[model samples]
Target: MSDSLLQLSAIDIATGSNPLYTVLWMHGLGADGNDFVPVVQTLDLPATPIRFLFPHAPLQPVTINGGHTMRAWYDIQHTDFIKQEDKAGLYRSQRAIVALIEHENQRGIPSSHIILAGFSQGAAMALHVGLRHPDKLAGIMVLSGYLPLVHEIRQEAHVANQLTPIFMAHGSYDPVVPVKLARSSLQLLRDYHYSVDWHEYPMAHAVCDQELIDISRWLKNILKEALISDHQNR
Candidate 1:
């Protein structure tokens, strides 16, 4: 639980632009924070100066292998309803999320200017942590990701003021996590009274062009609203 500074690192594009917002993005299993750098660039972020926090997951043993050290926000164990637990992985990454948010606060960015995002396993962590965030965030983006605890989330999720706007996208042909699973996840959130904007692209388990486009649009809306809210609060 002590500070290790190992959660996520950042890539600063558009250095000339005043960093107006912070986005904490996590990578999929076995990958580091750098995995999503391409997507960041593809967003065509302007010099408006946005800080991208690409947190590296803790190195731990994966179930796919004999306990080896690799980047993973948590372990997947087995898909059984009772055994689909992340245990230490989730708690450790949660602490890292806390550290990252605190660091952003020190940088003069408020919680309203922060966005939490991730893909695959990282995406699950994003939802788990972002939903439980005591303060409202600029937004929460989940790509090819599902809820870590569907039942527990509905029971415990909270936001400060505005409803937590979520963007959920999946690939129709995704075999790694399966597109149907993503759809089911979206439906479940909706059934639970969560606000979610859902999308599906004809691709595999990885990100696609349509997904990126939607994400960009989603962020633009959230950023615009965040700026307005900031000014109004002032």
Candidate 2:
């Protein structure tokens, strides 16, 4: 499918008047944008105004789930996720997400003022796309997900976001994506010299209160730096 045809429906939340930053957060398999909406209110963000876009993944038949139709960024062929990859689905979703970032730029938010984030399958997409994005982004936050299409990342990643700050958190007891897989992904990024801030929570394949607090603090720092940098550039 064409990128235009894959246009996603999203939930938009603005934190204050004249928002200066934008956050595009994606949800995991079988979930919609509304999945993370409640977490927004809990984040202890800075006083700066911010806008959040929670986009619903396209509906597709997931193979691992007995070909059941559900909202997924891409298909999961097997439990051994690294072996069988979904290149086409990933590329399609990447284009759709890039379109969302461009939409924010069109609305007056620079790419540098945007942060890409996700959980589970959504977190995989954040890592896949954010690294390849041609423009510099404020940062990327990934929770409970592993890097997909690993072979292509080294060749496809863009220099613009090479040094972009990355916040990665994984649950130690994540049965779905496995803590080991997440750690391997982290090692790959680190081997490539990516600046990553890592955290681990003693939970499952889900977000927790402490994770929310850490995310809030990380976002606060990132946006604060962005604001300062933007002011200096003026």
- The C-alpha TM-scores of every prediction are 0.89, 0.98
Q: 20-47 in candidate 2: lDDT tens per residue?
A: 8999999999999999999989997877
Residues 16-91 of candidate 1: C-alpha lDDT, one tens digit per residue? 4557789888889888877887777688654567878787777777775566768787777775412668656676
Top-lDDT structure, candidate number:
2
Regions of model 2 farther than 4 Å from truth: 1-4
Q: For model 1, how big is the CA root-mean-square deviation?
A: 2.4
Instruction: Report per-prediction Cα RMSD to one decimal.
Output: 2.4, 0.9
